[model samples]
Target chain A: MTDHDHDHHHDHSELSELELRVRALETVLTEKGYVEPAALDAIIQAYETKIGPHNGAQVVAKAWTDPAFKKALLDDASKAVGTLGHVGRTGDHLVAVENTPQRHNMVVCTLCSCYPWEMLGLPPVWYKAAPYRTRAVKDPRGVLADFGISLPKETEIRVWDSTAETRFLVLPMRPAGTEGWSEQQLADLVTRDSMIGTGFPKTPGAPS
Target chain B: MNGVHDMGGMDGFGKVEPEPNEPVFHETWEGRVMAMTRAMGAAGAFNIDVSRFYRESLPPTVYMTSSYYKKWFLALQDSLIARGYINDAEVKQGHAAAPAKDLKRGPFKLDDVKRVMTRGSFARAAEAPAKFKPGDRVRAKNINPVTHTRLPRYVRGHVGTIERHHGVHVFPDTAAKDAGEHPTWLYTVVFDGAELWGPDADPTVKVSIDAFEPYLEPA
Candidate 1:
């Protein structure tokens, strides 16, 4: 393979330092025969196209509509999620924390970004940044306020610091007025932040 | 190692600003870095704990300034070199000068992507019985090692209740050092927000963490 360069859009001068370093890293590894470029492409393609939070949305949707699944998910999240065929890296040992009227559950990986990638896909930039990591355990209410969520003062906020292998998924309380909605309809209302405990699922008839 | 990455409770970093409709990857290089890291990991270049140790061991200045993927990229290079798969000269020249070093596994192929993505569990059968159960009061030990560890600095020496018991799992503290897979019992320990912080802490907040058996003791 004569030095592959798919990035033909810009000259060397236009490429940022980080961009060039990434290209160089790949080149060296490929030349060493330690990695296949096709395999890298496949990995990227999987994250970019095949897997994501929508998978979690479907699981959340089913839990909202099915009573048995809701019980099973809260009991053992990894096994319940595996039943739906959503088991993989970063999602091996998942624990689903439910949000109730008396208590709310949120997740933050203060040490490193240990998110459930198989369920929630890649974490957002904010979730991985220093600010959220530092403040979430200290001032979770303030963090939730940044997300425009104002919970009742009496509602206990449970902040889960994902320090070990067990990843947490906040099972947001089902929004009202969707009594007869289908799982797909309910899933559409499930935002990534809602599952992360930063935001709630969209209200019925609200913009997606 | 109590590196800058254990950023819990300390102030001054600024507010959490979420990007609206954030793209999966901020830059093309970021996606490539992620893919390369994953692919190399699949080839058995290094385990996740070792990779994290490299990232955690970065100088405070570099660790604080680098973006998440940038950290991963730098860590991947360091891990590759440290594992003898590549060297600084090859990294700088952007090509291999010497014969490729043998890895524990061969090059990660495209066909292997699917099965690899469906990763296996880290949980192992317990060699001994669990010491505590849900509702048991326990305290996080204050001991800090100079190597890779999952216990954060904030929770050290603090008391919390064991809310749930997860079966034994691979201990990162040993795994990162090329030590044996000494699996141990894990639990979800819950702490009152006021206990973690001072009395000024919000009345509604409670924090929980997954603590391995070694990191905890009977309260």
Candidate 2:
């Protein structure tokens, strides 16, 4: 399998028909002066590089290493994340849910795609898809299994349905054998899926 | 109104397929749509709730057929027309019939994009004291208005406990109607999985929803 396949499950050979339609629509809108190309690039660049999953990874790593920061994150995620310079978009009222040995947390926006964009960036394709939206709440374990995550049988799963203004971020447990690791090292272990509660953080010495 | 967007307990959509090495966006058009939606939003063409209502109001077939960005494109088209930014003729003909009207400000500049995105309006305002507090029993009202609403149909009329108050924020039901913010207390309500999905659900799973106060009543 290719490196891409190893990262995620699905593959698309070419752009779909809907994508072509959107292209045409965009061209028309741009020509009509309703959208500015430079502005588009700016917005895309901000989410793509400057503000994304890495921000959340840093937040997770800090929470794992610092007890007081973890308490602040759990108490008022919006204000705590702001202290780390991550704030905006659906992140005004943030709530950090910690995943302990006994309770696992997962996030899904059933009504709409209300993600913590400033911290986690734009949500992944699956997070916005219909199946994940419905199944995450209905069959939590089954959904986790699809993502190759299997929690202990006794662990209680709490699915946070982001129906209103508050956005959720799942604080995954720190992996074993990384006790003395620095925050930067721990940040590298935190993956995008871990914060979303679809997968776990990378184990120490494991191939990323 | 039970819109197609409310896909909580319903079935038949199939599996959640994660795209391999998915870029921030799939294609150029998708990126454009995302940018346009935000730029237009910044331009004050429409509020977030109105934009959401546009997507929710789409025909079920169209709603299902369109991709995420495609829906945004379609909704942006509707918003542009409704807000007098563009007309149906211009959309169909692929060209503007007349010069676009001069606005107080132009589309977002590249320099201000970062600041605009990071510094979004909170929209939360001080209102009356919350009717319910943490650990209070409440039931989601079953009212299904044809216009925009944040309450999902699956949780309607269901009893759940208020986990915590989320402070007062804009109520989408009135926001979409262009009435006002109609700020209300929001809460995170937790319901037992069995309570929501009946006996077939796994008792170990619990579902929590961020519910606005108007959607809830003392149970």
Candidate 3:
């Protein structure tokens, strides 16, 4: 009925632009004795921190120095990550994929962001997007190449689907010439990309 | 065996290339709803008695229309509403109505919740079943018209063998069930890409998917 209301409605029909619409609709529904808006708001907020993908570099660093610990990690990630103070939720049954000159590892969740949240933290935007999920499986080399992450032709990309129960971590190859580096130093060489099985683990003082 | 999020290299058809464009950037009420959900969990509101709601009442459309978190959220809301933490009418109420009300719940008496969260880590640790032996050849069942299944689309109807019987793991299908939410029989099956995709794959490129028992048949 009002010019202002007409302009506001015309300017935005999409949900992203008009979250107020959700609130408005919730009000109308609730006032008419139908819906409860606060519960919906609470639920959505809980997941916003779910920005997907966390740091992989740190996990790679710990693996380079610890063998027995690494064995435990590969055996069962939930408990193994406890060695580094990362546990619970996503780590229930952990598996560490290896990336070597002969084989490489990558991760994707085609349906949703089923990532190893505790170990890797939140997943990166690209890691959870549909493009990476579909393309990485189709042309693994092409997608990695675009990210400036190329392995030799002989290398194999072992893509993993991270699930809510079972989690994944990439065991990146240790960089050369770091004969005496500490675990922390080695951890620094690992990256989020390497953990996702895209980029190679960085060499200390070596170019990425 | 089958992890909920292990979807990898099937075919390159579903990618939303170049992404989308031309939308004003703002958080939706959906986001606001998600935010409040977290806060409620933080505030210790609601008596959320979660018991794996995936086995019975899993909505058919949820298979494709929802994200993992959305699945989880739906699962949470379903169980909650079913038990009366909030009703359908409550869900319809606008934001800010259900703020830290007098609804007192939660058994978290003295100690922190850190201990309870580890319940999954210690379930049947040694009591779990380990049936299939590794290195045994088996044929994956020819599951057709699979509207709701975790078995990868690429590996179905293909022949592979039990690579490793990684003990008894939780069955997501069952865990996701509304009535019975518990883990089921799980095993890892190693399928050579040549067997799955034929000449398109290198012979050495073998993919091993940890599959639940329902998806297998004896070779």
Candidate 4:
């Protein structure tokens, strides 16, 4: 098949096939009283506004400044995260894997898109796409390179394939030159990819 | 089942495109689909395992081509139809033809949205002592059933070291078939890069998977 043939599958009419199917499913469910339309709005609103990587940044910030919290987080992540009211949905059974100079950690769901929704919000499209799922486990170095990250050959790259219920969160190393930085300032450096182990946290003064 | 969804160690799809400042949902319908799927789960229409099975049940061609939310949309319809909640006519007409079938739980409502969104615990009480512990060597079982299973094909028959015991959790193999939770011990099994891929694999890498007791045997 030509490249044009493959691209044609993604082309859509005025009402895309998926759009029509989703609308139909929602309408029928609403008519049957299985799903409340208002409830759908609530769910959507929460994900869009209330929940996101900012919540995870808070946890990372706390860990960076508080040694006690860091220990608790690294030891029992679910309990530690719950103490901060971040426990919900996919955030259950959370495990925090810390990155040191000698080791790095990355998380993927090879079976499906099993992400820690409560911690980092919804996963990005690339994380769910077939390429990331397929290559992250095999050629992690190449995958890391795609994100413009090149760890030293000495550092070990550990890829966590979330095949079961347990979810993983990467605790990226704290950047240097922030001796007296506040927790909020530290959090501003944490990006979603940093927590996913695809990119490093922004250095001080780097644009977000 | 060895399905297309088990996409570990495979390649040649494309580069990982990172969209800068991507929104939670690219489109309105995607959010609607997400909300509907979550609402049905909250209403106990189906468990996560069963929902996953339906997604895996899609034809390889459709599974490969459909977008993420599209797959969820199709699987949600499949589960709802299988459970008699809605039918082909209802989905096609965009309206219910008959009275609604009572859900396993009540209709997910606005009042309990937060509570429902807080996922319920899948961990169950351990029925017996765990068969494996941290630092123990175990091999992923090679058996592949035509029915639902959580063991990905790539890791099957591969030996790895037990990193941590995650206590007893619902076993997806049986749960997906509506057989029962059949709670079992779960662990984090860490395999070396050379163990999973060949020697050509990046030597500085390792892969870890959350595995149930059923999928492992003492190496």
Candidate 5:
């Protein structure tokens, strides 16, 4: 590992040292019949488009519109989410926490990036960075402030640290004036960060 | 282990920088690494816990300096070599020193890639019934083993209440070491902010973690 670091510093070339190493590794593995390029492309395509935050948005939209679904979701997220065809990988046992008028919920993985990849796709870079891991638990309000979200002074914050297998999804409170809105319209208001409890749903007239 | 990866309550890392309109993969190499790692994993090269342990075992300097996928690449190389899929000489030379040996299950193919990415096997299995239930007072064990652990350092030795029972799941510590699944009861434990971060912490804040049965004791 140190040798690679030394090589990285001495080689001031167009390609980054990390990129060069990855390219070389891929070359050797592919040449030796250990990896298939087509297989690699297929995996990338699936994650890029076939699966992502849209699945979570659909779940959130259903919860907002159907009180029965909301009750079922808060009761057993893994089972309720499965009803929407969103069940697999890292989402095997999910728990849904609701954000009500009195309390707000946020999710963080302090040990490692254990997110609901099946629902929300790969976590954003900031979610895996050190600062968010440390500060999210120590100063959650301050962290929310950094994300430009400020709750009412009297509202309580509940930070969920994903330490084990069970993953968490925060059901953000529905925005006002969206009454009788279609599920499709409500799904548009639901953002990835809102489901993670970093921000709120978009207002009705607000630009996406 | 009390590795540097446990950054629950440490300081001096810096502010969280949210990049606007970030691409799924920042560079071509990152995408390649992600795909390769997942492919290798699908081939039964190693389990998720073992992969995480390899990343956690890196030196702090290397772990901190490398980007996210870069770390994945490093861990992949180390795991592949350790499991006899590749060797140091071949890795250094960037070519096959000899023809690859026959794999029992065969390498992953393009036709199955999508299915592999979408399906996942559950690690949970039936175990002894849960010792505690929701509203039960419990305390985290103060342990710092030099092995993979799901228990975070900040919550160790602190008292919390059992919020929910998540049922039995594979214990990561033993699984990372190639041991049996050792499934145990899991629960969501909620700690008062003041108990974990001192009285200075906001009294209204509460922190919850999903802890395995072995990491908790009746308070």
Candidate 6:
């Protein structure tokens, strides 16, 4: 592929519903033929990959209790994350973004939806589209608001747009008041958005 | 050509209207196609194992989002190139060798394909020396050199905080190099909006990024 094909540097704009409909129709028509088999097996194998939803939750739960581990996670993720046993594929060089009270982070692979699927599980359908890519950069506030997350004006918002070369995964801050929560209790606080840096991990016994 | 990221601002478009769910039509066709293709692969297709993995694990976003045929075609290309079955040049050649496919269902040929499928490019990368360490504050280089690079354009020249020190690994850019080059040191660089977008950026906005050793200098 040409270098431009995989680059995720440019600002993304929105796509109307009509384009999506047309895209769907085109996709359906293209599928009406005898397909190649290796491709099928490849798709199957990717899903069967060890980096699924379960692995991502464990990373969050571990971070909740172990401050030293969190420091390690921030210092050298690929090796540090290994302490929690999540590696391989996309995460060999994992980068974990922390969302604190004054700052929030969000990740989107604008070019090709290059996600940390292994650690975060499957991505939402909208993530692969162009609108989310363009609008996310141009109007971070608006996009976050749609997801019902509006950062305070005093707080800063940074969007990490992933490209073909690098992928991103979020490491949510340990919530307050859950000083002695179990692993399962911590896992419950992790949401898909938190892993992507859109929403904060719900604090234990906090609002839904 | 339109910029690759211009999916939005696609003209005076309206809201995404909902359509009736057509899961069956999708499943039956995509399933049949994938199965038949995999069977063809079993017959006399290209490298079977590598093909199998690439086909299955391609960017699911692309597979589901792009035109169905585009996804299949690209997936095939990625596998071919990845396994060195064909390079860009070979692909450009248009006429490549037939896979060492065993006669259909004669017997599974796992060993033969294994070598090609699992080839690693670790030997080609040039390992980083000195450079920087963890907690280093570096500004990403703004270089726009035209070579194979893993550094994204948006992140170039931005200032960031180095989060981790991932041990050197193979650099995918020089992967085609027949000789050796150890992988470079890679780290995360966080950038503030004012740093990337100036006045337009929010005062408090901060964006962190991954920076290869070459893409950074001491800030």
Which rank order by DockQ, best down to worst?
4, 5, 1, 2, 3, 6
User: Candidate 5: where are CA atoms >4 Å away?
Assistant: A1-13, A85-91, B99-105, B119-123
Give lDDT tens digits, candidate 2, residues A1-208: 1111222323467655555545655566677675677888889888777778888899999999999999999999878887874433334777899999999999999877988887788888788878898898899898898887798888899999988767789999999999899999999999889998898999999887
DockQ of each: 0.51, 0.45, 0.23, 0.60, 0.51, 0.15
Candidate 6 residue lDDT tens string, A1-208: 1111232333447433323332333232223222233444444444445435556767768776788877887666655766653433333556676777777778866444557755765454456544565566546676676567677788777777653234566877777888778988888888777788766778666677
Worst 10 residues of 5 chain B by lDDT: B114-123
Task: Look at candidate 5 and tell me the lDDT of residue B109.
Answer: 82
Q: Clashes in model 5: which pairs?
A: B1-B147
TM-score against native, each model: 0.95, 0.91, 0.68, 0.96, 0.93, 0.61
| Model 4: number of backbone collisions | 0
Best by TM-score: 4
Which residue pairs does candidate 2 place in steric collision? none
Measured with C-alpha atoms, the lDDT of residue B164 in candidate 6 is 55
> In DockQ, how does model 4 score against the reference complex?
0.60
**DockQ of model 3 vs. true complex:** 0.23
Q: Give the C-alpha miss distance for residue A115 in model 5, angstroms.
A: 1.1
Of candidates 5 and 2, the better by DockQ? 5
Report, for every candidate in turn, its global Cα lDDT versus the true structure: 0.86, 0.81, 0.53, 0.88, 0.84, 0.53
Per residue, candidate 4 scores C-alpha lDDT tens digits across A1-208 of 1111232344554776667778998999998888889999999999999889988888999899999999999998878887875433344688899999999999999999988788888898889888899999998888888899899998999999999888888999999988899999999999999999999999998765
Off by over 4 Å in 2: A1-34, A85-91, B99-106
DockQ value of candidate 5:
0.51
Measured over the true interface residues after superposition, the C-alpha RMSD of each candidate is 6.2, 4.7, 9.5, 3.4, 4.3, 10.8
Chain B of candidate 6 vs. true chain B, TM: 0.51
Between prediction 3 and prediction 5, the one with superior TM-score is 5
lDDT of 4 by residue, B78-190 (tens): 99998999999989998889789888889989986888656667789999999999999999999989888878888999999999988999999999989999999999999
Please report the candidate that would top lDDT against the real structure. Answer: 4
Residue B59: error of model 4 in Å? 0.7
Q: Residue-wise lDDT of candidate 3 within B182-216, one digit each (tens)?
A: 55556767776678667877544555666777778
